[model samples]
Target: MTELLKLSGVHTHIGRYHILQGIDLVVPQGQTTMLLGRNGAGKTTTLRTIMGLWQASKGEISLAGMRIESRATPDIARLGVGYVPESMAVFSDLTVKENLVLAARDGPLDDAQLDWIFGFFPALRRFWLSRAGSLSGGQKQMLSIARAIIEPRKLLLIDEPTKGLAPAIVMALIECLKEIKRKGATILLVEQNFFAARELGDNVLVMDNGTIVHRGEMAALAADVPLQERLLGLSLEAHQ
Candidate 1:
């Protein structure tokens, strides 16, 4: 598979503290790569760094063989990189329609695209005119994902999408992501839910102390309970 995104010896700093330390990573075209780590392990920092919200102090970041480490956030987004942060960053004062409208960066929302998105998240359609802050947590999460994919993007960086969602919503999200992958959008997902990770991830990278501690196929990690324990400090089944 062709490499769509790559990071070589990347390092990031916030204030005087080092967040990422000489990290090397890769995401292949049309594949989902799971980033797993405990809290405060720099998983969010990695995604933010890739999105140019936090500049890398050292090393390199490339997308489609184009150097982007020094690019601004808007420039990176213009290169077809969509990001859905863990915070579910929705416009609290805006209606659902307004939110989606803003996310359609290229032009007006396409009818077919809206229909496809509604198929996965019917709530967004139902609450189209409702204020984003008035929606439930699950609904807001759905909207967050909807915004990232409102337009066709080459790659998506999603952080803990299933963090607080219910089981049915999580399953819906998994199916939606599978369809996105089927349509050739590469994804780098940070997820704590082992079930979703096992279902969606082609490969897995475990991070610890701001560095990759393990990298391999998702199936290999799922099948080996002891290895899962060693790397994640818990059984995959426990998270499921």
Candidate 2:
């Protein structure tokens, strides 16, 4: 597989804290790669750094073989990168329709694409005119993800998408992501839900104390309970 996104010796600093320390990873083209770890493991920081939300203190970040470590956030987004932040940063004052419209950076929302999005997240359709702040937490999460896929992107950086969602909605999100993967969208997902990770991830990277501790095939980690416990502190079976 071709490498869509690559990071070599990447490091990030927020004030006096050194968050990411000599990180190295690769996200292959047309595959879902899961970043899993305990809280404060620098998973979110990795996603943010890739999107240029936080500038890398050292090393390099390349997208589609182009150097992008020094690019601005908007420039990175314009380079076919879509980011779904863990905070569910929707336009609180705007209606659902307005939020989606803003997310369609290229131009007006495509009716066909909107229909497809609605199929996965029916709540967005129901509250098309409702204020984003008025929606529930899970609904906001759905909207956040929907905004990222509102238009086709080369790579998607999603952070803990199923954190506050219901089981049924979680399954729906899994299927939605599966369809995206089928359409050849490369995804770098940070998820705590091991079941969703096992279902959607082709490869997995485990982080610890701001560094990658393990990297391998998701199936291999899932089948090995001891390895899962050692790296993630819990087995996939136990988490599920």
Candidate 3:
């Protein structure tokens, strides 16, 4: 597969704190690469940096071989990159339809796009006219992801889509993300849910402190309990 996003020797600093240290990563086209790590590993920061939400203090970040390290956040987003933050970032005060309408860049909402989103998240369709603040956590997550894919995008940066969600909801999300991957979406995700990561990830990177320490096939990492214990310091078999 051709590389869609690449970060080479990337570093980020917030005030006096150096968070990312010589980080390097590659996101291939048409694949989901899971970024797994414990808290404070800079997973979220890496995603933010890719979206230009946080500037890289050093090194290179390129999307489809074009340099984007210095571009503004909105400009980077316009270059076919979509981001679904951990916070979900849905318009709580707006109706679901209105929220999606805003996500479509306030243009005419396409019926096909609405249909596509409904396929992944039936709840969104059911509550199209309901206020986004009234939806449950899982529904909000679905809406966040739906908005990110309202239009065709070359890459999607997703962070912790299943956090604090129930088991059934997590399973539903996993299935939905699998479908998204099948439709040729290139995704780089930060997830702590082992099951979701193991299921949706084609490739995996394990981070510790501030840099990635393990890079390999997701299946390989999933099958190796000792390695998981070493890197993640836990059995990658919980929450099943």
Candidate 4:
């Protein structure tokens, strides 16, 4: 598969804290790659840097063979990258349909795009006239992801999607993401949930203390209890 997004020797800092140290990652076209780690392992920072919310202090971020490291957030987003942050940052005052309109303006919204999101997230369609703040955590997450797909994107960066959601809701989100992958949107996901990561990821990169400690196929990592224990410092069975 052709590379859609590449981060080479990337370094980022927030204030006096040096969070990402020589980070490197590749998101191949038509595949879902997971960034796995314990909390505070820089997974969220990596996603933020790729979105240009945090500018890289060193190295390059290439999207479809073009350098985008110095580009502003909106510029980078316009270049076909959509980011769904952990907070599910929906406008509290706006109704769901109104928020969708804003997202449509940011990118082009055709009938097919609206249909696709509504098909994947039926709850979003049901609450189309509801205010964003009135929605549940899972509903907000669905809205956040739906807005990202308002335009056809070359890549999608999702950060901690399963956090603070009920299991049934998380499963629904995972299934929706799987459907998105089947439709050919390359994804780079930052997730701490082992079961969700193992389920959705084709490949996984385990980070510790701002550095990649292990990288391998998801199936292999899922089968290897010792590897999961050593890298994430937790047992997958315990998550069940």
Q: Which ten residues in a row have the lowest lDDT in candidate 1?
A: 231-240
**lDDT scores in order:** 0.95, 0.94, 0.90, 0.87
lDDT score for residue 35 of model 1: 95
TM-score winner: 1
- Segments of candidate 2 deviating more than 4 angstroms: 238-240
lDDT of 3 by residue, 180-238 (tens): 77888899999888888888999999888889899999999999998888888786876
Compare the candidates by lDDT and give the number of the best one.
Answer: 1
Off by over 4 Å in 4: 106-108
- 131-162: candidate 4 lDDT, tens digit per residue: 99999988999899888877778899999888
Task: Give a tens-digit lDDT track for model 1, residues 109-172.
Answer: 9999999999999999999999999999999999999999999999999999998899999999
Question: Residue 178 of candidate 1: its Cα lDDT?
Answer: 99
Between candidates 2 and 3, name the one with more favorable lDDT.
2
* Cα lDDT tens digits for candidate 2, 1-240: 899999999999999999999999999999999998888999999999999999999999999999999999999999999999999989999999999999998899999999998999999999999999999999999999999999999999999999878999999999999999898899999988878999999999999999999999988887898998898777766655
Candidate 2: worst 10 consecutive residues by lDDT? 231-240
Please give the TM-score that candidate 4 achieves against the real structure: 0.94
In model 2, pairs of residues that clash are: none
- A best-first ranking of the candidates according to their TM-score comes to 1, 2, 3, 4
